[model samples]
Target: MPKIEEAQPKYLQIAHHIRDQILRGDLRPGDEVPSERQLASSWKVSRPTAARSLEALSHQGLVEKRQGSGTYVRSLEVNRRARELYGRAKQTGKIYTPGEYAVITSAGWLEAPDYVAEALGLAVGARAVHRRRVTNNDSGPITLSTSWFGPEVGERAPKLRDPDRIREGTLMYVESVTGRQGSYAEDRMCARSSTDDEAADLDLAPGAAVLIVHHVVYDLQDRPLEFAEATYPPERWAFEQGYPIV
Candidate 1:
């Protein structure tokens, strides 16, 4: 079927109407809605407009899009899963380096969050040194990162405490002291939203997006070593992960 007008299509209006019916239980789960031809005839609109309405419903989770098959009703859970999948596909993925630590030192305020405490296995209000630096290729700071460490660790390396030195990068000091004899480290990442402050620090536009990166360095013993987090803007930074072949 032809696409509706790009400039605020009328079919989208029809789509919303059908969507309201679905939400009101007038169209129950597993209940098929009218076919495109039927909808076109009933609405006195083009077949394309009818098709667009169905497509819109498909996008909103009221209908499922199946290849070579007509659309069908989908559950709320299916809609959620579809949204998650779409988000995943949009991600550029995490990019980390081996044998190289990007030293980040930017000032971040300490607001106690339970997860941060749990990650470091430290008590609440325990002082942490967080760094902010951008990890982009000559693109300036693409992702704003605030790598954190307990104050005690930074104290050991007087340089870690210094704003200038820490800004130069302090992972080296952590590696020399608490880290094991490994040249490489492990980094774990998960999707998270950005805060207004984070968006500002990263120099992102309001409502601009970022990828939160959590990097943990471990000794050969597999014990928890150091933990740091970086927030990446999709424009400047991308992550590459390599998994072992089975």
Candidate 2:
């Protein structure tokens, strides 16, 4: 069989490989990562590409470089429990995990932001249904999630416009109402300073570091059904998953 190729740049592939090791606990905190030359030799890539891989990890706050010392794993806080939470929600009609609850801060029809509009294939500044919520555990707020849908979805699923929690979970509720099952989802993530609104919702000081995930769920037709932005306060949440190597 022909070998399947990765679409990501070689540097990113290297970075992701290292990241997986970290998340899998194969590389614990303070453990030294392979040197750039070693990575180049192992991955059969240029030294520049290997160095870029480490740089990418540093930007994600996954590793740190020391003077005269090689890079080291800086954190092992990444957990796969977040995925479990969603999976349980889908199966049990519960939106949150044990010891977690959410407050619906706002829910109504509003003009979608340009990015959200684009994700939902709507014109710029088009009106959409917006639902904002903050999930909290005993430790305090963990995530601030804002979900957007086209106006038509809101009209069909009127409960989406209410502040009450959807006992069936939003995704399931949408599927029930619209007959549009979520076929797949895409996530784009970045680390950046929290906005004032996000900081307030997540109970962090303004300008604090945050991990933002832009998530879009698509129907069988590959049309986006919902666009959500989930913001996590620094040091509070991380995502980890393992997959088979080809």
TM-score of each: 0.47, 0.67
- Badly placed stretches (over 4 Å) of model 2 are 1-83, 244-246
Q: What is the Cα-based TM-score of model 2?
A: 0.67
Candidate 2 lDDT, 1-246, residue by residue in tens = 112246657787788778766654456688999999998888888899889989988987889999898999995444323334456566556755555688999999999999999999999979999999998866788788899999889899999999999986788899999999988888888899999999988889989998888989899999999899888878754755323355
Q: In model 1, which range of ten residues has the least summed lDDT?
A: 77-86
Best by lDDT: 2
lDDT by residue (tens digit), candidate 1, 33-91 = 78898889877789987898898778655688667666667753211111121222233
Q: Model 1: what TM-score?
A: 0.47
- lDDT at position 182, candidate 2: 88
Q: How accurate is candidate 1 locally (lDDT)?
A: 0.54
Q: For candidate 2, list the clashing residue pairs, or say none.
A: none
